[model samples]
Target: MNLQPDARRALGAGLVVIALVAFSNSSAHISDVGQQAAVAAVSSTDTLTQLNQSLISANKDKGVLKEGELLEKAVHRKALMEILAKENPAHFLRYVLNASQISSLPKSVTATVEKRISTEGVIDTYIIDDFEHPEKSHYEYYFKRGANVKSLYLVGDLLVRSNTQALITGYEGDTYVVADNTKGNVTIKANKDIDGGSNEALGVQNTAVILVDFDDSGPRPFTKEQAKNIFFNAQFNKFMKEQSYNKVSFKGDVYGWYRLSGPSMSNGQHVIPVFGNDNSQLNRIILENNIPIGNYGRVIIAINSDFTSSSQVGMTMQYIGGREYFFSSSWISLAGFDILAPFPFTWTDLDFLLAHELGHALGLMHANSWECG
Candidate 1:
């Protein structure tokens, strides 16, 4: 799949960085996002275009229609329609369904959703068939359901533009959370003291948050010199300790400082540092039609920074619980307290911030979702 620089740029810049790669173009099946370009060939055929037109004519809702053909070509029709009517048009459909949502989706659909989410931010379609390959497409995104699957949705009302891409700017969708009950009693450990309150503190009984200490070996925006002090500072230590408490006191499991960095991180995905391995490493296998992470209960958590401004002193949450973290930038935001607090722009509230988002990661929607409910 020799993606034209334009295509790669298009992918990196498009609201959804969909890799319209190459494949054998058989009876149309799902495809992976990665491959040797020369081996696979993308469809130049107007099949997607035709499909797009058909959907628009059939479903005229503004959100659906406004998304245009790109969506139809990239995702599934049913999912897009739902996102349009419920997420875009501001119509609450889940209220009619009465089902609690999960935070991560299946690996297959999630892969495609992540691609769209990486660029556009919100997903309305699933990548089912990949004309690029007989067995796969450049990627696959679709929605499927099962009794054993845990589904999560995130909804927000904002928009974001990253790397010249147009994102809906908020989050509103669902994911799957496989309860870690396989271990009979899952142990959650943290690195610091436990406050024993709040949802995060209470969640300690079934989860864990690791307190990490590193010499700054992985990915980050701040240079080594700038981040050195905070790495081992007392406040940082206290934070980690508290994080440990949050995990252990709450019966959560924690793995000490681990390493994370790969294409996604290099591509500008700002994930946080944690102790154990969520096997997010599998995410690096973009076009394989396989997912190593996003299993049943284990959700990947990353610590992001609020470097939007120098004065800004808070933590930002990246809920990759979706194929990507947020649907649109507006789906989540840093609270005012994070900014006004006396923390540095570094990982000051990494643990606490993670705690807040972990709540969302754990199938707990905001109080607002109840209103929406």
Candidate 2:
């Protein structure tokens, strides 16, 4: 056994998020009518016993090394030596071969020499008893120094004759580490997947709702009357529906457009905007001026005069858990303004933008895949 340390680590890491996939013990077979009975008549108890013993021994010796023990330079030789000598003799050859290389064995094991130190092999046996009763045993071994051990299972094969690949430049003794020699740009980063909700149903209480406010200094770009009129409009209402904004009920009265000078504040849709360079500045205005919505409640959009076009535009596209947003200007485009342009310019887009952004801010991402909505 003496499974590779890397394989043990990888398996442990994978189990943190997802359990291992169970391998099926019995595989389906398609054979001629007469073959079924003939194949069934074979006795594989002896072979199974041997294979089980080998697997047990291999499993026991696998990863008997402690952390910080260099896999190279025979650091784990003590643990491995004991297993090879006292545990299971059937798997003794597997450890010995993994340590170095096997010159010859039962013809069942076929070794395919890959580059210099790497070798790939497999052993497939079909045991037939009297009356031509047959049972098949398949083993694939990948022998690669310092390479991952889980890859062997993935490669599929037996303990002795499994297909394996060793990196010629693999580490020595117990450790296997290869040097990277690439000149190209290498990007190492985590992959992030978008979060979208189930589309099969919609609920009013569950719908995304966002309230936006640009801090008040005086009159905002739009008049307060103008903002309310837009929020009540029908076109914007349809847009929210498309973006998965279930139902929105104004939580507070519209405070007319106001000037943002020092800080931005948020009371649902009402905001006091403070002059700032970017979204961070906008965030500051809210943190400084606005009161927080309870842990579970409606969406709030806070706008500030201090927010520049760059800051607003940047905020429109970003995603945050349990929230969503849209800049007033960006809202126009996102609401399909061109389609609604023939109609009056109202606060509908603004309202819908709040709903959409809150959808994301709360925990939603666009589902461009679904056709229904």
Maximum-TM-score candidate: 1
lDDT of 1 at 360: 29
The sequence of per-residue lDDT tens digits that candidate 1 reaches over residues 79-114 is: 543333322122222111111111122233233332
Q: Give the C-alpha lDDT of model 2.
A: 0.27
Q: Top model by lDDT, which number? A: 2
Q: Tens digit of lDDT per residue, candidate 2, span 144-204? A: 3221221121111111111111222221122111111122111112111112222111223
Location of the lowest summed lDDT over 10 successive residues in candidate 1: 307-316
Number of backbone-clashing residue pairs for each candidate, in the order shown = 84, 63
7: Cα error in model 2, Å = 39
CA lDDT of every candidate = 0.26, 0.27
The count of residue-pair clashes in candidate 1 stands at: 84
